[model samples]
Target: MYRLLLQNALRPSLQKRRMKDIWVWNGMRMTEVDRIMLGLRQRIKQLDENVVILEKEDDRNLYGAISLRIIELELAEILALLDTLNRTTSNYHHLIIETTAQLQDMMDTMVALVKFDKMQVIKKEHENQQIKKDLEKCKNEQKATLPPPTLSPGHCGLGQMVNVSGPKTYSLTAYGTSYSFGAWGRDVNPAPGNDKYWLVVLSSSNVYGHYVRQYSTLSTLLLGLGPTDTYISSSNPTTNTIQGPNMVMYGNALYYNCYYTLSICRFNMTTRTVSTVALPKDAGYNSKFPFGILGKSYDYTDIDFATDESSLYVIYATTGNFGNVVITKVETSTTPVLGETWYTSLYKATATNTFMVCGVLYATRYIDKETEQIFYSFDTKTNEERYDLKIHIRKMQPNIEYLNYDPRDHLLYVYSDAYIVTYEVMFQ
Candidate 1:
């Protein structure tokens, strides 16, 4: 009887020791799996870095003519290696899952052993009640310390307001002869305050004739211009000489970059007069890259003009200081002239496109076709930069050659290779 009583007294201690041993064994296995995963991740990152270097080489040099064959072979090898690593990682993951299930089963069996003790169960219930009271007290403290929320126009309720309604697809056809303008048309602008949604199309060569076509916003129909409509001028002094992949229409004036000159051209719609304004002395001009010779104008100079709800602004990087951006407001009451000027240290080359929205300067960079474009906004009001906002485009093209934001309708116009897509910008 004494031996039996002693065995019963030591039974709980033996069970605890077995549970501890199982936990230690499971922990060791989990740690090994984690180390393997970490190594695999590091290898993948190295491969990705190599791929980026290869892509840079392809873009900078003529990869098609010289290294195309070699690049193909290298890419194939890398892909195969990645596949092997992925399979190995998957097998390890499965092992981890199985081990985790075994650990859970051990824990459940240990919990079942405790079911025999009624006093232990009552103690656990009391402890759980105390934990609940502690959690409720923490929640109350957090609520009391939280700051009051600020409100803005067009915003209501505790949730964020997002405007996701806009055209998903856009149509782009040859405006004039195919030879007159390259694959993509030159510049496209919407007529200000026009209810009919009149779009102005310019040929690649500014010297060529301007075409005014109307599109029904309701029907998405592209109406060709009639022979009698003469809204687009056939002749202008700055024709062929206008330098731009950028243009903004404000009121009755169309402001454009003047080619071969450090100036911006202003064309009055009602008066039909052209004027030019010289940029700041240090404003950079022309592409600094070899590809700029291929007619990618924005590559050389990085000078751009954008308009917000209340004003027009010119943003450009200074020579020798490519990373510094200078933004100058344009006073268009008379001739186009620079207004309040501000400078930011953001690099201009990082952006594929830049535009102003409600006085804030936003720069966008391509983040692949599947993902949304990345954006960084510089607030002109507070001189602060923000990158926390989430903006998603349903579909993105490989290259967004041009971008324009229309504040009136909160629409973002994108000019990809041969397509002009517009997305509605929902502010949160």
Candidate 2:
């Protein structure tokens, strides 16, 4: 959407520039290079996400491909620079010619490597789809053979992670892509009269979101209807608005990381009052330790609120924990208070995002721009940790600014690049 709007705005100027100079019309294909570089910039931003995924997978072929990708990006950058350089002197012209040719050859090889990587990605996706079909059929057969001597199934009781599918894009943001980094979903624990789809988009610096837009239902949100409710937590951005993308709506209120502080804030919708509880052991905040692998951190994600079948939990990293993820149960029925705490071995900085289901915490890392891998798990029930759950998640975009599991429908609502996407979680 951003790209469409940008290209539309550029069309008139681009045409004007084209008509003004014949040389520009013919020789300035580098303008197109600028467009290509725009895509390259996006890929470059995901370098951290890619590195995290590649390191964990430990596939030598993928490692090599990443190496080639890095080289290709560098060469592409250099080639663009060389091509756009002002030709003021012929003194170094011959040298530039030789260097450009050598770099061009290297670029070609790297481009081939890039193509090979793309093919590998496509091939892997095909294999995964085939496996999914087989698994689905086999699951049905297995279900037919199972005994029905069980209690009623729900959240933690219903199942464990078997598979995740579909971003199932529901709607564009009420506010468009400029407010891309945001959070949206239905109230996990709505008061009877307060069940409305809500969206919170960061405004005025894209760090703090003060207002929330509420829709009546999935139909209203998907159809882009006007919000039924639009309320601000505070008139001031720094006072009570949410600090980060990690948030959840529960019990006619919004729970989130408080702005500029290492604390959880609960904004009651009924009275419009805000209550907060500071984290234990001086947890990091204000862009300190955040979600993201490598240097590509999602700013102000120092505190994350997640919901599962049982209750709401806060996921954060403290200095005492050395930036490792710390999970604490948050009681939402009353004044928000921290309850049972569980420490984990996973570093908060390494995980792109996390969610809770059946007392088990699942962490994700980027597989690529279009997919994410659920590679880490911490079972709070038994206090056991597992790193081998290779659950794959389909994503519409690379950056998942906000993600939380909803117990009501067993869906994962994700605010990714200002798009509200929900995934159907198949349980085992």
Task: Pick the lDDT winner.
Answer: 2
Q: Could you give candidate 2's per-residue lDDT for residues 1-428 as a string of tens digits?
A: 32344346446644543343344345444454445445444543454354445456656575667665764565455345333432321224455588899999999999999999999999999999999997896466445323322311334566656667666665676576787788888888787777888888887677888877788888888777977655555454767777888889888789988877767888887787889888975788888888886658898888988988768899998888888999999988657988999999899988899998877888998768876878888878677787766667767777788889988888999988878899977775
Q: Write out the backbone clash pairs for model 1.
A: 207-240, 243-259, 286-300, 286-301, 287-300, 288-300
Runs of candidate 1 exceeding 4 Å displacement: 1-169, 174-202, 205-240, 288-301, 387-390
Give the local distance difference test score of model 1.
0.55
Residue 233 CA displacement from its true place in model 1, Å: 7.7
Badly placed stretches (over 4 Å) of model 2 are 1-155, 233-236
**lDDT of model 1 at position 15:** 56
* Poorest stretch of ten by lDDT in candidate 2: 145-154
User: How far off is residue 80 in model 1, in Å?
Assistant: 87
Q: How many backbone clashes does candidate 2 have?
A: 0
lDDT (10s digit) by residue, model 1, range 1-428: 32244346445643543453355457544454344445544644554454455555635655534554554454455445444544654576678799999999999988887775766888899999999996896465334323212212221221222333344656664353232211121122344454444343345443222433444352443334331222434544235244445566666566666655677777665566778788877777664310121223344335677876677888887764555677889888657888898888677766666777777787765556643443466768778775543443444445555567676666776655545667766555
